[model samples]
Target chain A: MAVVLEVEGLKKKYGSLEALKGISFKVEEGEIFGLIGPNGAGKTTTLRIIATLLTPSDGKVTFLGFDLKKHPEKFREKISYLPEEAGAYRNMKGIDYLNFMAKFYAKDEAEVREFVERAKRICGLGERLKDKVGTYSKGMTRKLLLARALMTKPALAILDEPTSGLDVINSLEVREMIKGFTREGVSVLLSSHNMLEVEFLSDRVALIDRGEILDSGTPQGLKEKYQASNLEIVFRSAVQ
Target chain B: MKNFSHLLIKEIKELVNKQLVISLVFMLFIFNFIGNVTKSEIKKAMAKQKIAVLDLDKSEISKNIIGALNMANFIIEEKSGEKEQVVKELRSSGLDLLVVIPAGFGQEVSNFRPGEVETYSYLKGISMTGSRKSEIVKALLQTTNEFLSNEYLKKKLPDLDPKLLKAPIKSREFVVVRDRMAEGSTSAVIGSLYAQSFILPVILMMIIMYSSQMVITAIAMEKQNKTLETLLTVPISRTAVVMAKMLAAGIVGLLSAAIYMYGFRNAFSFNTGDIAKAMSGVAPILKQLGLTITTQGYALFGISLFLTILVALSLATILGVLAEDYRTAQSLTVPLVFLVLVPYFVSLFADINTMSLPAKILVLAIPFSHPFFAVQNIMFGHLNMLWLGIVYNFLFVVVMLYWTTKIFSTDRVLTMKLKWGKRKVVL
Candidate 1:
């Protein structure tokens, strides 16, 4: 498979504290890749760098053969990112927000409207289309965000804590949606604290701890390598 | 380009959603109405002063004195009472001035003796009203004395021509410069005041309303929503992003300025007759000032004014990054307003030619200051200074743009975390 995202020697520091230290990884096209770690394990930092939101202290990221540093615009054109706990403009209606997101990609109004309808259907936002986003429940908002990310059918969609704050039903729905991406030959780079969700959706997982990737493989592969029954055991064994 | 257009559309839509459009329209209506009404009131007030005359000697000289006083715009009310009543009336608010003709006033004049007429007003303190009334009384007395001298000359030389005895060289003044022709006319005074009073308040309001909290909130909202990160990753150049934001801000500022000017124009009550002809004469003076402002000059002036507003909004965005919240951003706006107001205050109090060197330098160095000076210079026909002020304004805006871009480009400005106030990052 062709490599969709390539990171080498990625380093980041917040003042005196190092957030990411020389982390490197490659995400293959048409695969759901997961970066699972503890609360402060540089998962978001790595995602942020890959999204071209932050400059690395010392490293390089290449998206589909384009250097992110030198050609961020070109790299960004192929990627969509939903930050962890991202908030929506409360006053804007659901359909309007969807249309706003579509503008980043679609040139014509017809294309924008078509994409907005698709996003609405995918996110189950039909009845709540005209409702203000501020009135949405957490699960509804999460679905809306997921819909926004998927609107343009970007080559690489980066989702940070995609299921966070979601109920069991919405969580299942989001997981199934993420799993559906791989079937369409779309690449995904998702970060999460829920090992089960990561194991179920990610074709391969990178278990990160203390700003470093401690282990990386398919769920069964990591389980066998760590001499464990599941990814939870594997993560526990690797971090310990 | 598509992304830029998208961003611009988003900005305009947001402006509409936020009700800034409604508020701005309302402000324009109120400001215009007030501006026009104040001008009308000033004109009415100027036409309404009352004068009282105390005639001790009811002679031809006293009658002529009353006639001259009445000939003026004043409403003359004659009184036959003690000097004290006239003094009382002058002290009261009803009377603007009182003229007392002495008992020997007519006899002294016939005998070739110097005569004295007393004028009184209760108005005290060094105010424009007091000074104006004193000037009017003095002028009336001087004219009366001249008429008495001509009478005495007629009496002494019965065959002497009274017309020949009149001052050999009498002067009649015509307004040479079109802009200056309004001098001493209600329009001129009102025009200068109109230009001044509205410029500062409206500019300050525009800067604070559109630039301060609006820019801060927009940026902070992006940061909060995480949309900023997604936007940065897009193929659009960072410079383009900043330019788009500045452009958006510039549009808002221009809209606000247009609203203000509309309000002021609606409020202004100048006589339209001969105004165009008068304005034409000032065209050469305007040209010398680097203005070249005909009606077309006003159009160019509008363009420059829009540029200056763009620069101001850009500077506001640069300052806004330092603030963490809407309140902090708003608090910081006070100093910015004060800075803009300094030029207006100086222009108001200081003589244009005798301003302190530092004030002159500061005024010339600031974009906002130049407009105040430019309008005055254009009106007064100081073409060289006007041109200098325009150039200085242009340079100041350019330099500010460079600095704003520099501040935007710095990495620390984007990522530097600011807690409450231990020490702010210097970026």
Candidate 2:
């Protein structure tokens, strides 16, 4: 399969602290790649750099043959980034927020309507889509944001902690949607602390700690190589 | 450009929120209602100057002086009580003046010597009225002295005409304007002009201050809500983003200024009507002074005023980006508030034309000061200064907008944090 995104020698420094030191990874077409790490393990920083929201101190990120640094706007057109703790405009309705996000990709009213319909079906917000995002519950908001990310049908989706603060039911729903992305031939770069969820969703995983990638392989491959029963034990073994 | 319209629409919609709309309407109504009330009060006739006299010398001359005070539109209340009691009443009643005649006052005047008639003045505060009335009283005293001396001369030269002795050379004062004699005090006519020019700056300040604050708060809200990151990631250029924000904020500011001007104009235009009526007799003088501004001049002034407001909004936008939250944003606006108020107070009293070179340069250096002088410059046909001010303001705003756009393009906008001691405040 062709590689959809390539991140090589990505180095990010915040003041004197080096957040990402020479990190590299790649996501194949229609593959779910997870960066599994602890807090402050440079997971979000790497995603932010890939999203073109932060410029790397030293790195090269190529998305679909386009250099991200030199052509961030071009990269933005083919990718959707959902930051951790992202919020929609409070005064805007759920449908309105979807339509707003859709306009960035759709050219005409008919295309925008089609995107909105897809987002509605994915979110399953039904009747509550007309309510302002400010009035939505946390789970419902997360679901709507997930739908927003998928509605554009971008080539790559960068999600940072997609299910960080959701309950069990919402987490399941979000995981199901993320799994649905691969079926549509959409590549994903996700970061998470929940090893079990990462094990279930990620086709391949990278064990990262202290701004360095310790290892990268299939979830089952990492587990077998570390003589571990699961990906969590594999992560602990590799990082420790 | 496509995203610019979307962003601008979103910004304007946010600004015209229900709470802000209510506040705007409330400000409009209160300003106009109170303005009308104050307008009518100013139109009323001047109140009488209350005076108290402790006349210890019960002579004809002292009585004549007291009568003269009363005839000068002063309400003289005779207080025969002790000095302490008189002083207490003087302080309590807010009297304008108090005169104490010594017991031998009549004897001194009869001897043709300068009498020591003590006068006490009770002025409430700094006002033009108190000083103006004091000047009038001083002139009256000089005339009274002349009357006494003239009486002495009439007795010594009984055969001479009394009129010739009192006025050796009669002179008539005439104000010449463009070879035409004009009526009305020069001070009154100038005061009317100054009053007309004064209000424009105040209205401009209200618009700039209020609108700048809104822009700051809006940017701060985007940061607090974590929406700025998403916005920056959009496919739009940074310049387009900054332009959208500035244009939207400018639109809101103009709307607010329009509403405020509507209220203030109705209230102040009433007083202006009275001034126009009173100043009709001094038209030739006004024309000679080149104090009549054409509509084209007003249009130029309006442009300068708009540019001044844009500079303020641009500065506010920069401050907003540096702020961590809404509270920090408001604190950051202190510099802008000072910039506005300093010029506001100075323009109210200082005649910029007569200021020293250094003072004039200092005032003109502040971009806000130009708007304060807009009406004055236009009225006096100071087109050079007006055009210079407009250019200066335009350049200032352009520079600020460029800087603001550069800020928006940088990563510093997201990473810049205000450090408070050991803690870092990041939005």
Candidate 3:
């Protein structure tokens, strides 16, 4: 399989504090690569850099052979970012919000309409899509945002804690949707604090702690290597 | 281009909502309603005034004096009885003025002794009507004195006209603007010009402040809602995003400016109806003295106004970027408001050129102050100053736009937040 994104020595700094300490990773096409860590483990910072939302202090990000630093707009055209605490324009109806996001990526009006229709099916909000987003429940809004993130059929979807605050049912639905998208040949770079969830969803998981990637492999392989029954045991043994 | 329009339309939709439209219409209705009511009241006050006259002598001169008062838009009420009785009655009679011609008043005038007419005026509250009544007393005394002086002159010296004897020397007033001179009352010309130009600084201040506020609020709301991050990552030019926001704010701010100016004109036109007519009368003299702004002058003023608004919007964009939430955005607008207020009051009260060096430089440092001075600078043929202001504003807007786009284009927009009473930094 072809590699869709390559992050080599990704380092980011804010004033004197080092957020990412020269970490390196690569995401292959049609795979879910999860960066798993606890709170304040630099998971969000790594995801943001790959999403082109922030420039790395000293690194190179090659997305589909285009240098992210030199051609951010080109990368932006092909990648979608779903921040952990993302929000839609509240005054806009859900369908309008989807349409607004689609137009930025679609080729023409027909494409925009097709994207909106796809988003409608993915979200499954039904007639409630006609109501303003401000009036929607949390689960409904999360589904709508998820649909937006995937509607454009981006080459790479960068999701930061996609199910961090969802209920069990909503979390299952989001995981199913993400899995369904990955099966269609979309590469995903996701970050999460839940090791079990990452073990369940990601094709390959990288254990990150204190701005460094301690270990990375298939969850089953890491569990076998650590002589443990679960990936959480693998993470604990690797961190120690 | 398409993305810019989409952003512009979405922004405008967010700002110009149903509630704002309804409130603006309601305010217009109220301003017009109050203006019409006060206008009619003023007309009624001008048409009629009531006064009491205690004609003690009951002579021809006293009757003639009462007739004179009657011709001057006053209703005469002749009172009789003791002096104290009439004087006390004046209080309850609801009359503001009373004249008491003492007994033997005609004998004193015939013997060439000065006639003493005791006048009683009731003190009332200091309303427009109450203050105007005191002016009437002065007019009353002038008319009575003129009539008595004419009578004395006609009897003592019958050969000369009283008008010519009263003013042997005539005074003519002329106003000179640069080289041109116009024959008119200097007061009338200055008053008319002041009336015409006084509202401009207010309008400019409002436009700048309103435009900046719209930008700040819109951006802050986006930040509060966390939509700004999603917007920044979208596949549009960062500069286009900044421009679209400022453009939308400009459209809404100018729309509000037009509506507010129309409402203000209607509200004040009723009270200053005569002033408008007088302005029209003085328009010719103003033109002769080169006090009117030309087409070129107006175009320059418009440019300055446009650039000034752009500068304010740019500053507000930076401020909004620094703000963490909606409430912080409102408090952040204080600097922009103060920038506008300083120039507003200065233009309204003092001449900018006559200000002290430090004060003048301070006022001119604020980009918004330029448009406030543009009208006068153009009217007075100070085209160089107006041109310099337009250029300076243009350059200022360019620099601010560049800086604003820089802030929006980078990660600084997300990470650079003003957190009060905290010392943690995150990336």
lDDT of each residue in A62-167, candidate 1, tens digit only: 8989997787777677888888867666778888888877877886889888778768777987889799998998888888888888877789999999999888
Q: Give the clashing residue pairs of candidate 1, or none.
A: A73-B235, B36-B267, B289-B383, B293-B297, B294-B297
> Which candidate, 1 or 3, would have the higher TM-score against the true structure?
3
What is the overall TM-score of model 3 with all chains considered together?
A: 0.94
The alpha-carbon root-mean-square deviation between model 3 and the true structure, to one decimal in Å, is 2.6
Better of 2 and 3 by DockQ: 3
Q: Give each model a TM-score.
A: 0.76, 0.79, 0.94
Interface RMSD, in order shown? 2.4, 1.2, 1.1
Who wins the DockQ comparison? 3
Report the Cα lDDT for residue B5, model 1: 78
Q: In candidate 3, what are the lDDT values of residues B37-104, reduced to their tens digit?
A: 77776775686788888889988877777888888888888889999998887787688778888988
- lDDT string for model 2 (A67-97, tens) is 9878888888888888888878888899998
Writing each residue's lDDT as its tens digit, candidate 1 over B1-427 gives: 8778777767655544546777777877887778766766566556746777789988887787788887866778888788886687567566667788978888887778988898887665544555566687798788778787777787888897776767667554333344443213344444434443445445544553455445555555555554565566555666666677667766665566667666665665433443555555444433443433357445545655655666666667666666655556666567667767766676666655677787677666666665555555655557678677666667777877777666655455466444547756543
Q: How does each model score on lDDT?
A: 0.72, 0.83, 0.86
In the range B1-427, model 2's lDDT, one tens digit per residue, is: 5767888898888778887789878987888888767655544214566667898888888898888888887777887967667877778675677788878788888887778676777788866556656765677677777777777777778788777876799765454544445544677667767655666677878888877887888888788877787777766787877777777888887788778777777765645676677677666667765667788987997899889878988898888888878898888888888888877988887889899999889888989988788777777667799999999999999899888887787667777766555466654
| TM-score of chain A, every prediction, order shown | 0.97, 0.98, 0.98
